[model samples]
Target: MAHYRASESKREQFRRYLEKSGVLDTLTSILVALYEEPDKPNNALDFIKLHLGAAGPDPADVEALRTEISELQQKCEALTEENNELKNKLMQCEPAPEEKPAE
Candidate 1:
């Protein structure tokens, strides 16, 4: 009775919100494109995700970035070691500070 009416009202409101936001149109267009394709993609889900811009970065691009990061990390480690060695040398060359006597 009243509960059924309330749920129906909520459903109508949600439908109107989806229509106003253009989500319905976007999804419809993507589905139409998929339906019209001459040679269907092997992975239909991937096709949809790719069309929706959620398929993530290209594999080649990701591999190149990983290689660059590894090279940079090695270079950073070498530079840190060199800096520590220089600091040790500087400390050895500099005389130690003397403590002042209390009156």
Candidate 2:
């Protein structure tokens, strides 16, 4: 049997949750709040610090995490859109088959 590293497992879990998290809104808010510093590393790190409730990360690690977050954001937007489309289709669908009167 093979084993996965703790970090790898955590990343997988993060990816799964991110797929469902609708992160674009949060990211957009962060970008808007920071206004003049959208790509400024400090701005992104500050937001991460607040939500993560942790001290600052190493610069290299923060850069990597930001990249991961960006990819996750894209995934989330796609999922959100797909989810809405599916929901609309479901709302338009007919009811399921009816059971027999006695059988």
Candidate 3:
């Protein structure tokens, strides 16, 4: 009975500390956002980590990176086509070497 009371007291103290530090409020807001999402995430902890900015870059940044990647891919394709065309043109312009009559 004494150990149970001590544990309860510790839990209450930790809760108070979280409230005092505004962590409770922040967590509440994140939870509310998670609750309101149309497609709820399968993992609550992962959702919370992403919302808290612990997972990685922001969504906007990710979108920008995706756009840049698409542009680079297009540019690479165009350059590859151009290189192939130039090689074909060079091959057509080159003549076969003449063979020597005697060694």
Question: Better model by lDDT, 2 or 3?
Answer: 3
The lowest-lDDT stretch of 10 consecutive residues in candidate 1 is: 22-31
Q: Give each model's whole-structure lDDT.
A: 0.95, 0.76, 0.95
Weakest ten-residue segment in model 3 by summed lDDT = 94-103
Q: Write the per-residue lDDT of candidate 1 for residues 23-100, one digit (tens) a residue.
A: 889888999999999999999899889989999999999999999999999999999999999999999999999889
Model 1, backbone clash pairs (residues 3+ apart or across chains), number: 0
Better of 2 and 3 by TM-score: 3
Best-to-worst order by TM-score is 1, 3, 2
Global CA lDDT computed for model 1: 0.95
TM-score of each model, in listed order: 0.61, 0.36, 0.51
Candidate 2: tens digits of C-alpha lDDT, residues 1-103 = 1356877888888877875796656666656666765465655676656655576667899999999999999999999999999998987895867888985
**What C-alpha lDDT, on a 0 to 100 scale, does residue 75 get in candidate 2?**
100
Off by over 4 Å in 2: 1-56, 95-103
Misplaced by over 4 Å in model 1 are 72-103
